[model samples]
Every structure is written in structure tokens, then in C-alpha cells.
Target: MRNYFIFVIVVFVSLSSSAQHTIKNTINNVELITVKDSKFFKGDKPYYFIGANYWYGPLIGAKNGGDRARLLKELDLMKAQGIDNLRILVGAEGDGGDSRVHPALQYEQGKYNNELLDGLDFLMAEMRKRNMYAVLYLNNNWIWSGGMSQYLEWNGYGTVPNPFLPDYSWDDYLNYTKQFHSCIPCKEAFYKHVKFIMERTNAYTNIKYINDNAIMSWQVANEPRVLISPDHETAFADWLNKTVDLIESLDSVHLISTGAEGKASYLQDIAMYQRLHSNKNIDYLTMHMWPKNWGWYSINNEKTSTITSIQNANAYLDEHILVAQKMKKPIVMSEFGFPREKESLNPTSSITNRDNFYKAVIDRITQSKVEKGVLAGLNFWGFAGFAKTNSENGKWLHGDDFTADPPQEPQGLNSVFASDITTLKLIKDANLLLIE
Candidate 1:
């Protein structure tokens, strides 16, 4: 009888110990991305590759009107093409309006659309399954997404001066958006959003966000700019630092970035770029390039202008690369795009010039990888996957399929469709070189 009781107790103890062991293993299974000596690493291997801006991923992953089939197909196709890193938007804010993302994640201050939140969970879960990483930006500087401006609007700062609307000019929008830096209530409300997102557990996988390996970094905002005057620099820097500090306090495992557009976000002052990013909490540097937007390329003068665009882009990249070297941080050209032949919105339009431009950009990273330089990665403007666009007018209506371009931009203007075989091949080949 005594031996029998002892045996039963031993068995029970062994089972309890096994259960605890399994739980611990599950919690620590993923190796989060880390940085050391100015480079990114994943489980002891150097990490460098081509990624894409798939900002609308979460929206499409939703159960309501969210096309799971298309999302799965796109993920598989991108994975097959060796594009594993994705820069995604965590969610959008404010009521869905003209030229704004519909079914927004946050429709009001402190209120959320649970469906969109579920979509975000689903997207993160799927990315984890594919062994892909995401750089999730928390907000946007632009009004197209109802970002900072929306927060200001919610705080009784008057209606957002949307630059896309005829009633407002670009200056009108810039001046209004710039006030976000100094608005106390707006800043506080945004911090609440930050905390809420950071603390939420993923509904699909049941893993807390801080422990999820699918997230490579938490970006502050998309193209967060100083806007118009150097006078706004002080306020902008303070806001940026506080945001980074909040993120760091919440999650010590993942990386943090400002999502800055290099000097372009700093009143064209590289020194200001360096000074702001000098924050010790910021893990890496990011820059964006738009040849057409910056006047380095012209659709009417494609032949000569394309060459000039490449040269100017290289110079711009080099200038920022120096800053990264000085700061001893890895730099990523997180956004860059070229239009199709003749700046056409048609998916069937020639991508010869676009491909050429992409190749030049990819080559820089590959060469840097060979030299073990700090130009660690590049994610082109976007990957549209299998999205069908309005090839004729490119205008985005409410129910239209989401593309890489925002609602305010022409749908196919800078989107890389799945049919862009040559561009995919370039990305694939470049990724191969990166891994080698």
C-alpha cells in the first residue's frame, strides 16, 4: 500500500513538471531580432534582405469583407519571391472619410473597431507562420490616414485641413499638422493608443505583442516630418523622444525606429536628422526617396531623367549612409518608388525604367553586404500582390481593392503587382545574394 501511494505521487509530480516545462518552452521559442555592432541578426545569422510596404495587410486580414484567400495567396507568392520582411501599419485612426482608409481600426478617440483589431492579430499570426518579420508603424504623418491630424481634430483643434481637398492648400495642411507636436491633449491621447496597442495580446496566437517574434520593430510613424520651419524642430524632437521612451518602456525585446525620411523630413537639413536620431533609444535609421516627388525625375523626360534619378538617389543614399556610420547604426532606405513607363497607372505598362531604378537600389545593399557596410536593408515603396486596380483612371473608391498606394495616391502609380515578373526576379536574386 505504501509503495503504491509513493508511485502515484511520483507520477503526479512528474506530470506537473512536464507541463511547466512545455509552457516555458512555448514562451521562449521565438528568437527576437537583435542588433549588435551596427547590424541586424536573427539567431546568430546576419539578417539583410529586400522587404516591402504592405501597409493594408491588417485590413485585408479582417473577417468582414477581408479576403483571406487573397491574403494567403499573396503571402505565399511574396515568400516564394524571397521577400520576407514586411513594413505594415498597425492600424489607422479616425472616421473613414474621403481619401481615407475605410473601416478604420480606431474610429474615435479611445474607441476601436474590434474587427480591424482582429485583422491585425490575424495578420501577425499569419506572418509568424511564414517565418516573416514586420516593421509596424504606429501612426502616419499624412492626413490620408487621419493620423496626427485626426488626433488634433479629436482634441477640438478644428477640422483637419486636408491637403487633398480643394478647400485647403499644402501650406494650410502643413501648418495645421505641425501643431500636433505642441498639442498637449493630442499627445496624451496618442500615448494612450501606444500603450493600448503594446499591451494587447494577439487574439489569434494568444501571444502577447511584446513576446511576438513576427514584429521586427515598432516604428514611430510613417514619414514623420518637421514640416515647413526649423522652429518646429524642438517640439518634434521632444515628441519623438517621449514616444520612443514609451515604446522602450513597454517592450524591451523589439527594436524601435522613427520612420523618418532622412533630411527630407528635417527641412532638408541632414544635421537635424542626425541630431534627432542621436536619441539612444532609437535602434536604427530609416530614409525614403521619391524621385518624382523631389523633382529628380520627370515622366516626360524619362530617358535622361531616369539616369539622373539614379545618380541623385545614390548621392542621397550616400549622404545618409555617412550619418548611419557616424551613429554606428544600420540604415534602411525604407521607402523608394518609380512610376511605370510614362508614369502610367496600368499594370501592363512597361516597367523597364522602374526595374532599372530598383536594380540600382538593390545593388547598393548587396554591395554593402559584401563590404559589411551599414546600408543593411531596403523595402521598396510597396508590394501590391494580386490587387486589381483601375488601370484607366487609378482613382480609389471606397470598395475598390487596396493597393500599395494610399487612397489619396493613384492606385497603381508606384505599386509592384505580382505580374511584374522581372521586378520579382530582381528582388529574388538580390535576396539570394544577401543571404549568401
Candidate 2:
């Protein structure tokens, strides 16, 4: 009888122990993205910063659609180069009237490019197979077609929904916005989109990644900013905040990010908006800034330009990062690049050397408290671009010339400085994932 009791007790103890042990693979998607170590999250997990920031019509199955074949070819090579995150673009309103909704969800008549959906599908699958994460950027400052774009004008400022789009007349667009906003399919659509993204990729699982989930998180927007203009500050901020809320309300599973446009006011606005909506709603803060134009391109100042533009950026990062660190938000650098144009402030400056600028700036950024804790990841400027005759040329991207000062290979200066491919290998050696 005593032996029988002992055996039962042993079995119970073994079961309890097994239950308490957590498999890192079975991590809570929410907790996995937390900035600090809490009861729920494993904060000590080493970070691997790898990614790219591309906007416009790169992923939406437009003319230069990102096909699965091309995406896989790129990702496979980059994996060797050390890539972990691919920041694909998603705008507030779909580019074309009937193309935005996933084909599966869109009415037959509304369906445009199923290829975009298929490409996204392929991407998610590849990442999961490699145990990687694809951070899908929800929106960027763009409007290729209709709806909320009728009122705004194009300006270099990050004010309004998009520079190319029309401004919002709170009196007029609000009703339309409310109605449009209300129409989001919420949870059902959210899950369907994500599930499709995951399943489509899962079609070709390898032995190393036979079973896995979708990409990492759903980024809120590309670079939402109010800028020096007081124009769309309130409305844009409000819209972004609501987007975060809606995403969270719909699915509490995947992590969500605030793709805050990098600027003094924009960062402040996003932080404020984030607080108002719910601090915990955001997994982290990701923004884009080119201090060279703003003026901090080089600490050395090799370039001769007004220091005011750069001073603000240098000061802002130095100051805010301290606070952001305390908040424990992971830092994800979605975009960082210096224009190669001679007009670029950082061009040929004491502070403007490519390697000098990127290396110097990034070193300081990574050393910050927030960087050490949660913000250890960043995805720079863009991934791929061709000199192909762009449709947006002369119209929208007239100034976005990839031509170098002497016109080297497009983003040559910055690209050579970062040497993303090599950087990834270096980062990986240290157990960090570097994708861009």
C-alpha cells in the first residue's frame, strides 16, 4: 500500500514539473515583444536587428509587384547575409480602389492583383521556415488613388495623411473617416489576413521550420508625423492612435508597433497618442529620421551646412532616448538614410562621411539604455530599387533621385557604409539577427 502511494505521488510531482517548464518556442506573442523582462516575457532573449524600410507600391502587387520568386531569391540570399525582418508596406487606404482588400476578402469585381497577396503569402512562409519575423508596416505617407486623398496637396512635410494626398477638413472628412474607419472588418478580417499570410508561406516548410506561425508584428504606420507645420497634427495623431487601438482590439495575439514618422513633433505626438490610447497597446516605438537633412549627419561636420537642422536631431535623440529608455520600449529603426544629392546637408561634410555618419550615429544609438534593453533592432532606409523608369517619376519621386553626387550606384554611399550583408553576418556571429 505504501509503495502504491509513493508511485502516485511521484507521477503527480513529475506532471507538475513538466507543466511549469516553458518551451521558448511556445512563447506568448505579446510577451515575446515586451521591452523588459516581466513574469510573462523573456526579456533576456538576445536580439537580432535585421530589416529594410520600403514604401510606395513595392509590395501591393502593383506594376513593380514583389513576386514570390523574387522575394524568395532575395530573402534566401539575405538570410546568408543575416536578415531577420522584412518591413513590407501597407497604406491606410489601398492604392487602387479595388486592390487593397485581400483577394480572398474582396468581391470578385473588386479583385485586382492576387499576386500581391501571393507574394505576401510567400514571404511569411519563408520567414517562419527560417524562424524569422516579417514586420509588416501597416501604413506609410502615400495615396496612389481615391477616398481620403481629395483634399490635400503635396509638400515635403510629414503633415497630413500623405504629402501627395489632400488634407482633411475635420468638418468634411471626419464623417467619411468615421464611416471608413468603422468599416474595418475588425477581428474576422484581421485574423483572415494574418492567417492567409501564415498559411501561404507554410506551403514550403523545410525540416528546420516545418511548423511555425506568421511574421512578427503588425506595424501601425510608416512615418506618421506632424512636422514643423501645425496642419494635421491632431487629426493625424488621432488617426494613428485609433489604428493601434483597432489592431489591438481585433487581435491581441501578434505584437503591434507605432511606425512613428521621425521628427521632433511627430515623435512627441506618437508618444502622446500612444499614452492616451493605452501605453501597453504598443509593443515598441519605431521611427525614421535623416539628421543630415535636419543637420546631424556627421558629428564631425565635414559637410558645410546650417547646423540648426542637424542640431535638433542630435539633441532630440540624446534627450528623448533617455526617457524612451526608462519607458522600456524596444527600439526598431524602420528607416535611416542620407540623401546622396549634393544638396544633402551631410554631403561632403566634417560630419557627413558615409561610414563616419552611419557608424558613428548607429554606435551611439545602440549604446543607449533603450537600445540595450528593447530597442536593439533597426531596419535602414530601403532594400531594393531599380533605375527603371518610374511612373511616379516627375510626379511624386522627382527629388528621390538615387543618383549619387557624381552619381555612383544609387544609395552607394550609405549602402557601402552599412554593408548590410556583411553587417548581418557580423551581427549573427554575436547571436543577433540583422536583416535589411
**Candidate of highest lDDT:** 1
Which digits, one per residue and each the tens of the lDDT, describe model 1 over residues 1-436? Answer: 9999999999999999999899867755666788898999887888887999999999999999788888999999999988889999876888779779887889999999898899899998998888899999999999878899999999999998888888999999899999999999999999999999999999988889988888899999999999899999999999999999999999988999999999999999999999999989999999999999999889889989999999999999999999999999999999999999988999998999999999999999999999988898899989999999888888998878999999989999999999999999999999988888
Per-residue accuracy of model 2 over 187-222 as CA lDDT, tens digit each? 234334333333333323321111233445777645
- CA error at residue 108 for candidate 1, angstroms: 0.9
Q: Choose the strongest candidate by TM-score.
A: 1
**In candidate 2, residue 331 scores what lDDT?**
56
Model 1 regions lying over 4 Å from their true place: 1-14
lDDT of 1 at 118: 92
Tell me the lDDT of candidate 1: 0.92
The models' CA-based lDDT, in order, is: 0.92, 0.44
Error of 1 at 393 (Å): 1.0
